[model samples]
Target: MVLLRTLRGPAYTRILGIGDYRPARIISNEELCRHIDSTDEWIQDRSGIQQRRQATPDESVVDMGTQAARAAMTYADLTGSDIDAVICATITHPYQTPAAAPMIAERLGTKNAAAFDLSAACAGYCYGVAVADDMVRSGRAEHVLVVGVEKLSDYRDLGDRGTAFIFGDGAGAAVIGPSATPGISATTWGSDGSGSAMISQSVSWTEAQERYAPASLDMPGDPARPDATVTDSLWPFIDMQGPSVFRWAATAVAPLCERALAAAGVTAQDIQVFIPHQANTRIVDTLVKKLRLPDHVVIADDITDMANTSAASIPLATAALLRSGRAHPGDLALQIGFGAGLTWAAQVVQLP
Candidate 1:
């Protein structure tokens, strides 16, 4: 007869620190108006974005993510060698081969770190945080770095007013480690595949290549749409139905936050901060009113300056709030992320 092995119990986990990196150059609405028909007032009134950061020509997704991870490690008082796993959440990675996470880990000197990329578009970071936290709780890793980074400027169609002024580039990171008490509560995550088409790239790379190749089929520009000027080549950029996304975000996400709060055994009044994805100010405003969070609860609106950085928005906004003293260590915060995949994830966490 063989004896049975004892199983290890799940450990508690919490975020240790957070960091963010924004590109050096800032592009204002005035600058964007030069290429698109939209004016500063219209852009501001519609999206509440005055300006956004644009990555320098030399910057790559890995470059921004590495900087972000390093900053997070520094804040956590740990070096890359201390990290056991790295999870990068991004949609703008340039290459189809060699995912961004390993490259970032190597640059940060994390030798043989378990690294990979997670793609859920704007909801990627929240998904990453949920995974990282679970990894720690399950004893799969001691310290995990979750980074949300994007280089949306590379794909933005300059003449397309819908997206031209709405995206930027940046990276944000958080270090998750063991905690004595529950720091990150159970996550509330789900997806609506039916709405996936509401946000997507205009065309796949292979299709674009095949269609735009020499001696390819006729692919003329649309005469009706002012910005559809490409006659031969097509750049696969992000496209979305703005009103549709707004409606889904405004109506669906509030209940998820409530579920997350309940999972954490907390209430809206108990939350000190509300950090939803920085998609737009109007969405933020709608969520705030619907949630009926107390007047004292701080709400993040980094979209005004950072624009929508996709996967990078949540962590970036969280880091900004903590760094600016709008939120503090030990405060309870509710974080919700929703986007492409028509995916969403929410959780209540105690601030590091």
Candidate 2:
């Protein structure tokens, strides 16, 4: 066993860089309508999504995540060897035993860096940001990489109207390092477990496996029979109560934003960008109106192109805003993420 040493001091943490990786395959609304009972106009009117990116089989969650991380490191003018820790936020990691963080660290060549994964659904990115800030402030780390990635194409049910059109695959990352001045404010987070079922998998993986387990090696029915069939449950896919989620997002999440702003000692008018999770365009509009933000505040609408990327949504939206010239470094931005766990988190931070 090895001994560990701890350090203590007051430090400030700020995001040094941001990066994102969107899959190459773009699926238009017309293409989606082919598989589900949805139309371009209907999808636009409801979700404001015209197209979404779907990852190919070659693009695994870790692959996209590592790419985003490398880009972020480059933008920060640092190398993998410079990182002290890594935090990977995702719910779509294919393996159940080993987390995705260590693999990401290994690929980044951060052999001595502490690595781990966090699962908070759509709220994961913001939570990771909060944790990174705290870790730096407490002198536990000097530089940290926070990555949010998802491969929802593997979990989406193409025939389900409720979710078939709402998910996409992508990854986004940010580099957090010590700063001489404050760059990130306090975070506000909460969850309503009673509503956890509003967004979740239709069935658990173990349950699905058991449901399809063979009754016996000897076939119960004739193998050649035309009518022979096996009773099995629907494939485990992401599902959501659309109305419930919309209601909760539009109404309940506004207070969390208010709390975040208050904690940061800022007002709605002080914000330069509002980066909420790309869950729905309508929800973004609702929050903007409910918060009474000024017309000058740029709101992220990445959902139109990337759909809801769950834990990756906030970082993805942030990167898009910065890349589009709509927001700039040192700008004040408010970010909020909510989903699956009936969880939500928010924070106000200055851009890199």
Candidate 3:
């Protein structure tokens, strides 16, 4: 097992409550096949994604994030004013001017609360959770709202098979408060910036040509190589290195999982559930085999029904499991996230 370098910190921060919001409108694979050149069978075979939920045309990232925050605050029996801080994770926000988190706090009526946005790609929620856990544990804040919300479809190139079939829209959230024991036990986290170039969104400018500049959101194409003078033509859409990502995810997630389990002094058998990032079912299955955890460990994922919600995936699945009575109070649960940044993290948590 991988060992910790620093002594374990006190368990003073805990996840007190959680909530999620999925748009009422659903997008099925068959419907996508009609719009794009894809088949339900093919999409399932590649990513195990059968369908997705997308926000209404009128809904936006901040709106979804705010909505999820409200639900979490209600569950925590706290008002926006009660929260000392807020951290929102999203790759897609409506505008580049005003940060989404502060706007959400305003919408939630949190007075003078510190708030900001975070982007660790799909691994954002894990990172955010870790950040909030620390801030609260250090007595910097009492109650913090860590939100993972995304609207990937709004910027998607619906015609591309790789990305279109992989993303859906939704939001998930958690209210973290101080806990005495069995709260956030141990977490393993790391990132590789070199991999950040692999996935992104971009825009360009033209010399002395105002007409050439488009104000609308545009996809940032892949980075240029010195050897290849010819950069491919630009398109507005998402991109993925399917095979590389799958490999990285499978290999990257296992170590973090092992470390977190060890830190909690819990065996794999002690874990009541494993809520992995909802990037792909294939990756989850691969890790399940690698870890050799319990067959009844109760792995939860909603990608088949909700698609990949990026940072929102794990918390969304966790909340859904709780709502359905799958994950009960005080149960031992583990969560892991891995994606762009080539980042990954794992933490063992106790249900409140």
Candidate 4:
């Protein structure tokens, strides 16, 4: 065991490049209207998604991730060899065995790059960025690619209004590097296992009812079984409690944003932009009103075009802002990610 020196304060992280990928197939609300009892107006008002891109049945998750990753690398003006590590954040990577990060590494030909995947649900991107930052700051890896790619459409129950209307498919990537004056500042992250039911499905419930019935039920906490699980079904696909999640996000996000800003020694007024998790337009709108942040300081745009891309939301929004020239180097960017750890993570980053 080694005695630690004073806690290193504000280690640098820069967002060197970023990109987002939306598949070519556009599925309109009218398309959903034909299949389900949903109107364009109702869907738009509720989720801010008028249309979303769906991947072709043949498109692989790796293909999508690789496309976004290449564009990000190009934007960063760096080659594969320049990357020291790659962090891929995906909940829909197509396989359970080999992590997609390494596969993405192989595709990008980042042979020397250290790679791994982080499944933090929608908060995965923020978590991945935090991990990559530590690696560079601790002198383990210098340049890292943090990718948030997901294809939630594969698991979505299109017949279920609550789940189907909310999720869309997409990918986003960012290149994070070391800088004395960081593009990223302090981050604040939190989780509540209690709310796990609000966003996940229970696979064990099915197995128990089908495979073992009656007295042999697999309920983790039968008095006979002390080791029974307190909860079940964190697998299969995401099942969300929309109104509850919106309320939680609205109530929870601002304080974490304030906390992240405080940790960075900055104020809301000092922030140049806010790239919050694109969970819902309503939640984003609600928090913007609640925080009293300036019009220039917060960006809640893009839900109309993309829906919630889960972990990919923030980076996609960031890329749009840069593309539109709404942002410039030296701008202060505040990003927050919340969901399915029933968790929230916030970071205050300075943009280059």
Model 4, 1-352: lDDT tens per residue?
9987743423677888888788887777877664457898999888788887777656766778888888888998988888888898877775777998888888898857898888888888888888877777777777899998877775554546766677777888988887877677767888899888788753444554454334234534312113322221222445787888888888888888888889888888998888888878888888788778986774847667777778877777787788888876678988888898687778887765
For each candidate, the alpha-carbon lDDT, in order, equals: 0.87, 0.86, 0.79, 0.76
Count residue pairs with overlapping backbones in model 3. Answer: 1
Q: Estimate each model's TM-score.
A: 0.92, 0.91, 0.87, 0.87
- Candidate 2 vs candidate 3, TM-score winner: 2
Per-residue CA lDDT of model 2 for 1-352, tens digit only, reads 9989877745677999999999888888897786677799999899988888877766788999999999899889989998989999999887875889888999999958999999999999999999999888888888899999998877776657878789889999999988888899999998889999999887888775565335423324212111221221223577899999999898899989999999999999999999999999899989999899999999998999999899998888888888899999999999999988988889999998
Alpha carbon deviation, residue 221, candidate 4 (Å): 40
How much is 297 displaced in model 4, in angstroms? 1.7
Q: For model 1, how does the per-residue alpha-carbon lDDT over 163-263 read when each residue is reduced to its tens digit? A: 78899999999999999988998999989999988999878887756655443344333222233433223346788888898898889888888888898
Tell me how far candidate 2 lies from the true structure as C-alpha RMSD in angstroms. 5.5
Can you rank all candidates by lDDT, best first? 1, 2, 3, 4
Model 1: what TM-score? 0.92
Q: Which runs of model 2 end up more than 4 angstroms from their true locations?
A: 1-6, 210-235
Q: For residues 118-221, what per-residue lDDT tens digits would candidate 3 score against the true structure?
A: 97878899889899988887667888999999987765655566676788899999999887764887677888988765565533323212322242225333
Window of ten residues with lowest summed lDDT in model 3: 222-231
